[model samples]
Target: MCIAVFLWQAHPLYPLFLLRNRDEYPSRPTEPVAWWDNGEILGGRDGLAGGTWLACSRSGKIAFVTNVAEVGKVPEPKSRGDLPVRFLESKKNPTEFAEEVVMEAHQYNGFNLILVDLSSKSMIYVTNRPKDEKALVSEVPPGIHVLSTASLDTPWPKAVRLRTNFEKFLEKHGSGELPAEEMADKLMTDATKADKTMLPGIYSVEFEHSLSSIFVEANTDQGRYGTRSISAVSVKTSGEVAFYEKYLEEESWIEHTASYVMEQTGTG
Candidate 1:
C-alpha cells in the first residue's frame, strides 16, 4: 500500500477504521480480497510474491505495510510483503512480534508495518528504515495517523491532505455511521499536480504528476501505473468486522465486501 490512514478507538460504534490506497503498476496480477483456503487470514493476495500488503485474521488481528521511499536503496532478497502476512498468521503478542521483526528487518527492503490486536485494544507501529540504520517501534496512541512511502506521518502533501480529510469526515459524522462507499470515495479523490509544492527531502519535482493525488495514474517504462485498490475496514467495539474493498478485476473496477465476527476467545 502506498498511502494509508487509520483511526483507532475514535468511534463509538466502530473501535477501529482503516482506509488505504494500494498503488502499483496496473499490469500486476492480483487476487481480490478473499479467505485463503490454506490459511484463516482474509486479504487480497499479491500474485507475484504470494504475500499481502494488508490482511486481517478472524482472531481480530490486523496488519498493513507500506514501502519506504528512498532513491537508489539496494533491494533486499526477502519480500517486504511477508511482514504483514507473517504477523497475521503467527500467535505472538503485538509487541513481541514487532520486536521479532526488528531483529530481521534489515534482511528485507525498507518498510513500515502496523499491527493491531482488536480484542486487547493494542496497536504497534514499526519501521526498519529510520534516519539511522536502526529500527523503531512504538505502541501507537489512540487517534488518527497517516503512512506513506516517505515514512510514518512524514507530512508529504498527499498524506497530509488525506489525513485532514479523514479528520474532517470524523468530525462531521461524530457518532454517526459513515457509509462505506463514501469512505472509499474519499480515498479516490484526486489532488492535481499543481496543488503540490516540492519539499526538499520529503518530495520533489521528480515525483510523477499522478502521485499528487490519493488515486494515481502515471506512465512508466513498465506501462500504466496507478492506484489499484482502495480498501477500508470497520471494526465495532463488540468485534464485528466489515471489510470494503475496490479494485480492478478483469479490466473493470469492482467493489467487494466481507464480514467476520470475532470469536469470544480471540481465536478464529
Candidate 2:
C-alpha cells in the first residue's frame, strides 16, 4: 500500500508539491529515485514488477498509484504498479490516459491512480475499487489532497493527519522554497497510529491499526513490512523540479536527490 499528499496548483511558487510513502515488505528489491536509462523519467522503481509507484517524465508528466484497502482481492490480478509507468510513457493527457485505464480496470486489483501533466495544469484521479460501482475518473481540483489506500481524500486517519500537518508547514513556509528534506522528515516519518474506532474496517482491527500511521511499520510472519521509501517532489513555476527520496537499503536508510528542468511545452 502507498499514501501520497500533493498540492496541485495551490501554491504560487510551486505548481505541484507532492510527498509520498511507499509501504511494502522490507525484503523487496527497490531502486531509489533516479533518472531512467532513457534520460527522461525520474523516480524509484519496483524491482519485482519493474514498475514505479511514483514517477515523472522530463516532459512534465507525473503519476502515482496506491492500492485499495479491500479484502476480497482478485486472485493474480494484473500488476497495479504498471499504471504509473504506462501513463508516464504515453503521450495521452490525464483524461485520455485515464479513460483507457477504465476499459481494463477490472483486470487489476483495486487501485487509485493519479495522472498529472504540469504543462497543461491537468490532474486526474482514477480508481477501480468498490467493485460494486463503476470505475471513477475525475479531475482533481487545485488544493492539498491525500491519496491513501482508499479513494482520494477519503479522510482516513493518516490522510487527515498528513493533510493537517502539511497545511501548517505550508503556511509557515509561506510561498518560499519549501524544505523538501525537512518536510519529509517531519511529515512522512510520523508513526502515530489512529485510534481503533478510526481504523478502516476493510482489514482486521490489528492489521489496519498497524497501517494507520503515515509511516507504517509492522512485524508480520512474512517479515518486516512498512514504508520503505519517502519521496518529496517540488516543481517550481520556473520549470525547475526537485525530487528527493529517503529510502531503506540493506537495512540502512540512504537519501538521494535528482534535479531537472521540465521541457517547455510553450502551451501553458
Candidate 3:
C-alpha cells in the first residue's frame, strides 16, 4: 500500500480516471502484467509475491489505493492490488465496477481509488476514510486533478507532498513538458518539510531525490510500483492525448503499468 493519483471531471471522450502507485516491501507477494504468450489478456496480480500495484485499462477504466484502514476485525479483506488486475482485465462499466466493489468492501482493507471509463466518461472515488467516516465517492471534473485525503488540488504534508509539488509544476508549465528528472531537486524541499502523515521516515530519504526526477510523470499501469512516467502528457491541445511510464527497481513501478487490462487503453 503506497500512493494513488486520480481525477474527477466533466470532459469529452473520457472523464473519470485514475493513476495509482502501490508501494510495499519487496517480499510481500505480487506479479507482473504479461500479454499472455498467445496474446490473451491475463492482466496481472497484486501481492502475488511482493507484487506492486498500479493500473488502468484500454477502456480508460482504472483503480488503485493505499492502506488507509486495515480491516483486522473483518478478516482483513484480500488486498487492494488484487482488485485492479481483476477490474482492468475485465470490460466492466464504471458504474458496475464501483457497485461491485461497494458490495464487497469487507473483502479488502482501507484504501482509496478513482475508477474511470473512457467509453462512458464517468469517474468515481471509492474511499474508506479510516474508521472515522463511512466509505464515500463522487464525480470529478475535467482538467488534471490531484487527490489524496480529498479531491484537493494541493499538497498535504507527508509522502503526498512530493505529488503536490508536482502539481505546482503543472501550473507553472501550463503543460507537462517540464522535465521531471530535472526537477528532482524540488523534492528535497518537500522532504525537508514536516512529516504530517507520520507513516515512516520516507521524508528522510531526500538523498534519493535524484530518482524522483526520472519517474515523476504519472499514469495507469497493470501491476507496478515507484514513480512511473507511464504515459507522458504530451500534445495537450484540444482532441489529443499522450503519456509514458516506467516502474521501480524492487519491480513495483514496473508492475503498475501492465496492471491495466480491458478497461485501460490509449488516450484520445
Task: List runs of model 1 lying over 4 Å from the truth.
Answer: 131-135, 194-196, 199-204, 265-268
- Cα lDDT over the full model 3: 0.44
Model 3 poorest ten-residue lDDT run: 231-240
Off by over 4 Å in 2: 130-135, 265-268
Instruction: Give the per-residue lDDT digits (tens) of candidate 2, residues 40-111.
Output: 888889889998999999999999999988878787889988999999999999999999999999899889
lDDT of all the models against the reference? 0.80, 0.89, 0.44
| Residues 1-268 of candidate 3: C-alpha lDDT, one tens digit per residue | 2334433342233233234333434444544444433353333355453222544444454455445523243465576666665666666765677778777776766666566555555666676542336345556566656543332333334346655655666557652345433343343222243433333333334422322322232222332233322322222113233323343445343412233333333334
Q: How many backbone clashes are present in model 2?
A: 0
In the predicted model 2, the residue pairs found to clash are none
Q: Give the range where candidate 1 is weakest over 10 consecutive residues by summed lDDT.
A: 194-203
lDDT (C-alpha) at residue 165 in model 3: 58
Q: If the candidates were sorted by their TM-score against the true structure, best first, what order would they fall in?
A: 2, 1, 3
lDDT of 1 by residue, 225-250 (tens): 78888898888776788888898765
